[model samples]
Target: GGGTGMIGDPGGKTAERVLLDAETVARNAEAIATQASTLFAGADFTLLNNADWLSQLNMIEFLREVGKHFTVNVLLQRDFIKDRVKDPEHGISYTEFSYALLQAYDYLHLHREYGCDLQIGGSDQWGNIVSGVDFIRRKTGNTVHAFTWPLLTDKAGKKFGKSESGAIWLDPAKTSPFAFYQFWLNAEDESLGEYLLKMTMLSKTEIGAALELHKRDPKERHGQQLLAREATTLVHGAEEAAKAEQVSQVLFGEGTLEGLDADALQMLKAGAPSREIQTGTGIVDALVVARLASSKREARQFLADESVLLNGDPITDPSETLGSDDFYNGLALLKRGKRNICVLILK
Candidate 1:
């Protein structure tokens, strides 16, 4: 249910992870919990901290109970182990070596305690999942199932959320709703099908129909649009998703700011070039201050050429000053030419 396994991971890097302290782990757990709740909203679910059971596990008792079922040869042959075993200088540690055993016992405990029969996770967890299934079978003589999906990846095979920009955090504060929406909106066309199937709740029939429409007109980005809207709504709620989409549209000149809200205003403030200015600050000063223009002369040139847009309207007066009347909910959207954008936060 979580990525805590990464803490004991040997498959990812040549070196062992720098273990997180208790307080840091607990802090991250809260963030992960909030993300999981939103992404799985309306589902009946109970979260578990593997640390609760794993930490208290008795090592000698574990070897006698669960470790006997696994032969050293088979465990040594595991791909993760093979990678480390081949590199004597960076060989695996006992803690990481035994991580799979802890995970196996986890499945056995869930089976005995909760009647949990099926475990689903990424393909990278295949070895751990099998260990659990085998441990449960040897212990209780009951069969459990392990289902693994294809590892979600981009065209270059790098895992999703592990992009060049770093993990796409589920927290809205870390990644604003608008930015979250745009990540999917900007997904590569070749990767859309897999992303649609694995990441969204849309049915095959619907996705198929959309893909067909997209193929005929790739320029419109119908598939990417559907993926963006659905994925954003799933993570951030529909209302926030809509506001993000609206903010994106209004900023891009494709739509008006008629429905802009306070949340969207703050999103722009946090994400774009912005500066807090008192009401009635000179327009040229505001522009230079926000870095939309480099100097007063450049700011004046933009104003003269009708390249400055305030709240989606042309600002022709070079001497005009920003006022409360220009702000929407205490923030004003300022644009220079097509791509340069800034926000003036009313103090």
Candidate 2:
């Protein structure tokens, strides 16, 4: 994705891409390399950046070597290309139009250099992929195979990563492990089976069994839980997955906050409402501050009803105070009933 990242892939776009600067492309390439290395750990593979060759090509030489094989008529016949060409406001750019040739050259280069014979990508890349296959056959007269799977889409038919919220990045900095785990955990029931089958490394037998179990009680979300756990473990590692799961359980009242540290509690900031308050804040005031109760009167009523729990202990006394002992590692888990929860971070 080195050179290709600069000119974004126009597979499913309605408009031309804003080209990236060289530095941004390099940074993105490095990030992608790191993620690929982490995800494909223990697999036998060599990572190669197409920029290694693409960046060194002479225009005239490349036109003679590769461009001549591709025809405008064939390129325009592609669905994406055709769509772009039909658009009056945002016609395709020559840079993007030439992507197929570059990709075709990539396949040829890999086949010649690394003896790589197979190219795989999403169904969106079928046109570009076949272009590569045709290029290789023409250049070296050697046959190569290509395969593509259907694009992963949610229930709304939008591609998985292109959500309205924004792209779900693999980088932990861009999207936290907890957020990433939650994204899968909140997957729609209709899409759960496809997500489990495609996203995780679970076998068919295991998936079938899980689906069967999930069918008995969809409310339990056994399938989603499994998918979330497996997907999070694959991307962020087992420890991070465990941490995310722990935070999730504590938030849902299925687990305790006993072992949760500041890091684990931090994950709750996204799932549960939180506020900062000094230690020794009155229980009534704390509940109000947490938005679990509308006012001091409401807070007191909740406390009087024995519905409020401070660190999982029912607090019936409105006069009770939250002190340093109430906080675990600068964080306190406050619960009102089973559904509503809030975190108080000591200021």
Candidate 3:
């Protein structure tokens, strides 16, 4: 799979991919392996790099043994391949055209060395998965299985797992646990059920209960909350999932500021306006400092309107002062309304 990744899977692409250099591919493969180790920690599976055998393949021998089994006519009929061939602007390259052969060989090698008989992938890989099954049967005269599930897509038919920022990454370094959790937290109501079924390991009974609760009040977003929790837990572990959920609740004004660690507060800081203020600062001054109000006069007006909150509790008194007790782990939150929040850092 690592070797195949280098050439890039052309199954779902509209144009030829820029091939990865050996060093980049190797680094990516290693990083993927590291992530997989944590993701599949308790699973009964062995990870293998396809490059172990694929890199050693002799071109002539591969053509004779693997390539000979596949016909150009069949390859040309693949949906992606056909689309590429028909599009003059982005025609398929020989390197990409041979992707199926390489993937087929991966299956053959796995079958011979590991007794693997089943290959599962997205529907987009239907052709490649079938090619593997057929190659295995042709090479060893043994039947294998290919299973493809529908790819998750948005209502508009574009693929899921991408945000306005860019493609979501499993690595927290690329997409923080908070960002990852938010992606699922914001799942559309129409697709929440499918996301729960495909993206989470929740049992049908559990999902049904969540859906029932959500139906009672979609405004509660119970289904999305459940999906977000389960999906985040699956990828980032239970502890981080809990932290992400807590941060989300705090940001949304549904949770208290107590018990948030520095990392969680740091994440919260990123999404809200922030300013430093001295201890015992008056609410009016704090509001202006945090930019929740443009001026002390306006800040007092907001407070008088009961539209201000200090650490999630509505504060209507301009005289109310933020002291050390108000800061949680050196940070506090100010709010003029549900959506306008600011982080207050102790100075």
lDDT of 2 by residue, 235-271 (tens): 9999899889999888875677777776776777765
TM per model? 0.86, 0.92, 0.91
For each candidate, the alpha-carbon lDDT, in order, equals 0.80, 0.87, 0.87
Quote model 3's TM-score: 0.91
Ranking by lDDT: 2, 3, 1
Q: Write the per-residue lDDT of candidate 1 for residues 52-108, one digit (tens) a residue.
A: 766666868889987798888888988778898888788888878877887888888
In candidate 1, position 269 carries an lDDT of 63
The true-structure Cα RMSD of candidate 3 reads 2.4
The global Cα lDDT (0 to 1) of model 2 is 0.87
Model 3 lDDT per residue over 254-291, tens place = 78778587777778877567888899889898888888
Return the top candidate by TM-score. 2
Candidate 2 lDDT trough over 10 residues, lowest sum? 160-169
Q: After superposition, how far is residue 99 of candidate 3 from its true place, in Å?
A: 0.5
Off by over 4 Å in 3: 161-166, 270-273, 280-285, 288-301, 317-321
Q: Which of the predicted structures, 1 or 2, would earn the higher TM-score when compared with the native?
A: 2
- Per-structure clash totals for the candidates: 0, 0, 0
Which scores greater on lDDT, model 1 or model 2?
A: 2
Q: Which stretches of candidate 1 lie over 4 Å from their true place?
A: 1-7, 161-164, 216-219, 278-286, 296-307, 315-324
Pitting candidate 1 against candidate 3, the one with the higher lDDT is 3
